[model samples]
Target: MENRRFDIRKSLLRALFASLCGVSANAMATEQYPCKPAPDEGRFAWGRIQSIDPNYLVKRILGPYTFKIPYGYMIGRPTPERLNCYPKQNRLEFAFWMPDFRAPKKDMWSEPNYRVHEPGRDAPGPQEYVVDVVGLEFIETKAGKSGSPGRRFVNGLALLRKDFRIEETYGLIHVVPGQNTPLSDDYVSLSNEGYEILLECSRPESRDSNPSCKAYLYFTDLQLEAVMQFPADALPEWQKIKDGVRILVERWIVKEKPT
Candidate 1:
């Protein structure tokens, strides 16, 4: 009888431990996105932005989907004063910042003499790139019969071509300016990577614009789209940037186990 009573107690203890663990996990999950939703304002309902640690895991939920972003990334509005928030017109927008693999240097000499004297020291070091990711819950009205994410991507490309008069010839994409296109004469040239490319600079006529490229990509896996702005000079490294962005999105999505 004593042995049987001890076994029962052990089983109870195991159940109690499991329950505690489950509660702890749930608490952590709730803490991921600590913003509180406010009443509807205009078209969007603002969420109170909190002073969160940069290393904190951020979470975003849309309909039946949920995304959990790991540490070393940042997400927020364009400006703190901006009242725009999610669930606006069935779309969500946010800025994401991640480390650039090409720019691994975090520290550098600040002395002007050192910079001037050292060869290749005056050259600028790569900095973290910010990408705007927009989540669309509904299919675009113009993207007719975009049954799959891939079709949606094609539709996006078509729209860009129609609006900007982009021409792809001999393995190169030439951005030909249209009547309303805010592009200079061949200001943006890109090799097609299956993503929409645009000018990243504010002034397309300036010399700085030549080296920058703004790319829009549709993520089929996540059923979302992202706009990445990076130096066009690093066109050769487009594959790395694309892969990194994919990994970032993949990390955010929560995978469900088969029942």
Candidate 2:
């Protein structure tokens, strides 16, 4: 009886140790790739404050899709007037810092000097990119029945041209016909809201040695329209940047295992 009791205590100790080790492993994994789990339906619906982690990998459910947004990406906070929460069907606005971009330790989303670029004072600041994802319903409102992705893209270009007065203004257009013509299919050069924007209608064929443009892309693969804004100088490596953004979006999606 005494030997049996000793064996039972040994087994219990082994089980406890194993459990603690498993927990430690999980904690380490979380530290390496910290991600906030999906919020409950009630919390999402009520626009309640969920986790307070600065490096939040928010999980959002929109229609048929579930997105697990990674860290360095800022999720749109819900407001009293505009409750931009989960299970949303219309539009969602989010922003992300490029992988190379170094974000602040805290309040990265609301940092005042995020866009400031003052050489000598400090290191070069990375550009901030904003993206807007809209559903078919929102697209229908913008462009009528023939609101195909191609059509919407064309319309966007037309709107930008008209609004920026590209024809009327000189030097507004960055490309100089034969001098600095971009390798990309289409490039729009204009300044809006204090930022010089270089819009790309489609992917580029090759990288330019002295590419003089940022990037704005319209993606329709998510069953929703996604409009992206990034620094224009990155245009030379547009394909890589495009791929990176696509990868980020793809990673966010929670894939289901085969049954």
Candidate 3:
């Protein structure tokens, strides 16, 4: 395993950006971006926050969802250190564990020294990306611009791609442009850490005007299901993950396979 301290630039950049300017009361306006954490049921864009992190940017992808999040926060353990809350009502919870950003690829998710894993129905995917947390302004997620996140607000994505050592970028760690991208037929794929994670979305089959199922998320590692519904008291913390995935149908990339 590569030492976490191998990256010196990220630390230096954090120190440099911390002095630029503090967020003001006007920039803290709630109406700037109307982002209420509720399921739109189908595809849509999540609100954006102009976090003060210069090295970080908008646009993280997971399965059918693509939304802006604070940079440097990797797919953490299923237990979220920060945004952790839910009511008993048809609640949904999601957690992702990102692999160390540049661990050499050697089929760790399949034939590790301790265990031999299988992809089950889906094939193994590219290794995942991970990062450590320090001075992140991502916590102050305020109102953001509506509609598809424009390139201007999402400026940090390019920096991440240039600064980080990424391989086979997938899901939240891999920041792809646009919401809809071409994907494999399989909804599940393996990641770098030798664990099976849900990688794609298969539209639910239904003919009725209103389908019987509501969107729910699965924690691939724990094999736990969070059944979600729009309760009266649902908070942003509860609906963040579902909103990310639910919005994918409205917009996506649909990339072509390499020749």
Best by the TM-score measure: 1
Residue 113 accuracy (lDDT) in model 3: 22
At residue 20, give the lDDT of candidate 1. Answer: 99
Off by over 4 Å in 3: 1-21, 25-32, 36-39, 45-98, 101-259
The clash numbers for all candidates, in the given order, read 1, 3, 14
Q: Write the per-residue lDDT of candidate 2 for residues 181-219, one digit (tens) a residue.
A: 333434443333212223453234355432333244434
Taking the tens digit of each residue's C-alpha lDDT, what string does model 1 give over 79-122? 12332223223444443433442211211112111112224544
lDDT of 3 by residue, 76-168 (tens): 211111121221112222222222122112212222121113234223233321111111111111254221112312343443333333233
All candidates in order of lDDT, best leading? 1, 2, 3
| Model 2 spans > 4 angstroms off | 1-51, 78-89, 99-122, 125-149, 156-221, 255-259
* TM-scores, each model vs. reference: 0.48, 0.42, 0.17
